[model samples]
Target: MFAFAVGDSLVALDAVKIDTTDQARILRGGQHFQQTCLSCHSLVDFVNDPVAKELGLSKEQMPVWPEDSWNGHPPPDLSLIALSMSPDWLFTYLRTYYVDKARPTGYNNLVYPNTNMPNPFVDMQGHQVLINPNYFDKNHAHGEQFWYRVIKLKETGRLSPAEFDDYVDDIVQFLTYVSDPSVHARRQIGPWVLGYLTLFIMVTYAYFRLVGKDYFQSPKSPPPH
Candidate 1:
């Protein structure tokens, strides 16, 4: 369980960074996510198919990845992965896939060490290896901060470093949207629902003042007998 630091050059992602709202990026991310992640992790909501119309992607363009036959135990469901794990975690995790030839998949994560998973986008982002891991003192760093802060790429891959970051960002954005497809509609309908409730309360109060109690007073108990 390695913790990430703010100024660490190896994992340069910010914990407080915001997710991108660009529709194009988000849509592209949905494509990549379907291509890579869905192969292992099943999205629980795909049976209803909210992703296509909501994200402006078609079923053909973003078909779900075929069921994985590579591993015996199925990977964890990813329906809420983005929500449970923040966008920064997802982004940083996606980008910091350093090479470790000893592992079965030949890759280990910077954020989560000794991980069993492989880098799905290895060709696009390339491979990296740890550099200085000297900050191992108890008082130096703890909790969410690790001593290591650098990694050097051993081999270059298809996409340049900058392009890979942008690609990962787009995927993160799509995952954030996938967590809650109804968020946009909810926001849109929220104001109207509030307005209707307010109007109902005002109308009910007006009715009470005008004729509600006066017309039904039980004749004041027959003038107190």
Candidate 2:
């Protein structure tokens, strides 16, 4: 019986330390979305479609890259994904897609069940996937036991698991920021706030120095004594 413990489930990977304030990160994220995620998903003007209406994008403006181009499953609109899903969940899910020859789509995912999206990054990381021998039920025993494993390319892929994970995290963070651009502005203000505090301290110190100069003038009282 393949029973999963609470902790056994794949947790979201930790957030990466990319400069969230970097415009480059956001631009790269958008480009990556266009290249990878847009095939199935639409982020631009996503509001027209009933299913994607909540995204606030109109169909015409929605970024649309057909899935056929990349052998991808239709990607879902991600406009509100950051709001609905945690960053870690998104990061882990992105890293979890793996090849499953037994699957109709030739791929499976731990975060999503029977996903059609094949592991696009598998070529970068060696093929790998979770395996559970006990998960097999005699009647349903095709390859259910291999559920959570992540498979990747043994050699040709461009990134290692850890490196790819960071990539996913970068995308997640960028999306999180996009869902609300205010987040980016708020973060940008952080340094300014610190700078103001430093200036306040300097000004206060100067004011005290000026006061001391007038009040304690060169030991005049000691000379009189």
Candidate 3:
């Protein structure tokens, strides 16, 4: 059994330092998307394709895109994945693909139902799967459990579970940033905009004081009879 806790704050903390601003990270994420996900999923315009016609709607209607890009199946656009899915959900989903003999692809997922994408990062992150005692009950389904007991990596597995989480965080952060590239620039300029507004208010106040001081200070003329 995998000894893991749900409220592990340390794992969350590791993700905080991920540099979404780094150009390298952004480039890597784009590369990863292109190499691993582009064949099936259309990031921008999915509705025009034949698959969308068959599916009755665009890929955006679905929660997430499959790892596999099928010929008949149109891959959904992932541009909005960051906004649509939570960080924790994304993190857990990325780490949850496991081998299941019963599944068509011999794999199953916790975040998604009947997923078709194979684990692209299995070699890097190792394999994990759902461990529900009552596998048949749809409503009472349980969560996943990793094969930490059986599988172990040969090399490049130095990072513990916490470290591995940071790796995923970096990727997720990069994707989130890509989802809205303008946000980074907007946030960077927010303080400057505030500073300019403050300066303008001060200058305007000074001008008003200069113009009105004489009117208030001037001795009141005697009222005309």
Candidate 4:
């Protein structure tokens, strides 16, 4: 399991670091998700997330999705996605969608081939095409490494490349926060916890020094007696 997870994380090294603490950005992501993903994907755990509540996000505001499935493919709940799949993996997967008419969804992903989830950011991210669609066999025998080299943006989208990246990053950050709602409280208290430990250690050391001199030190020689 460790190696399997690590292999997934190594899929893309270019993934940008996410700042989950940015409440404003997380809010933007949450709103965008409500508009786009919530129509199909449900975040059951996130509905009761304290951080999400503080951000004024409510599941009641989301559109009701079918209880059965989405086109025979039940959309997976994404509440724990950022934990099950690394943020880097999610970020890369979202950014690496390429046009594939062969698929029913008219899209495919580099990280996950033949993904059931449609390209949610197509309008903002624009169309990406494989530079060499024929280089590999129909079976995709060449694997993921080749896919990384072949995908290229064919048309500019509403958002510039950089803007699109930031947009995706925000969404990924929001997911990450949802995975571990306690993160905000932990980060906020971490510094104070360390400070308290440091102070305790220092006081303990001072007391040790003050008492050790009398307890451990040899008595002064009695004037050469």
TM-score of each: 0.64, 0.55, 0.57, 0.72
- Shift in Å, residue 4, candidate 4: 12
Q: Compare candidates 2 and 4 on TM-score and give the better one.
A: 4
Question: Which 10-residue window of candidate 2 scores lowest in summed lDDT?
Answer: 1-10
- lDDT (C-alpha) at residue 94 in model 1: 73
Candidate 1, 23: how far from true, in Å? Answer: 3.1
Instruction: For model 1, state the Cα shift of residue 203 in Å.
Output: 12
- Which candidate would rank higher by TM-score, 1 or 3? 1
Write candidate 4's Cα lDDT for 40-142 as tens digits. Answer: 7777777776666765667675545564656655677788998897887788888888889899999987777667789998889899998877744554432
Q: Return the lDDT, model 1, position 96.
A: 71
Local distance difference test values of all predictions, in order: 0.64, 0.58, 0.55, 0.76
Report RMSD (Å) for each prediction in the order shown: 6.8, 9.0, 9.7, 5.4
The weakest ten consecutive residues by lDDT in model 3 span 7-16
Clashing pairs in 1: none
Task: Kindly list the per-residue Cα lDDT of model 3 for residues 96-165, writing each as its tens digit.
Answer: 5566687767766554545666666665666554444354455532343233422233334445667666
Score residue 219 of candidate 4 by CA lDDT.
87
User: Which sections of candidate 1 miss by over 4 Å?
Assistant: 1-13, 19-21, 46-49, 53-73, 132-148, 190-225
Which regions of candidate 2 deviate over 4 angstroms?
1-19, 45-74, 131-156, 186-225
List model 2 lDDT by residue over 55-153, tens digit each: 333556555556464454455567777766656556666766655678876767665556566666666555654444333233442223333332433
Model 3: lDDT of residue 214: 84
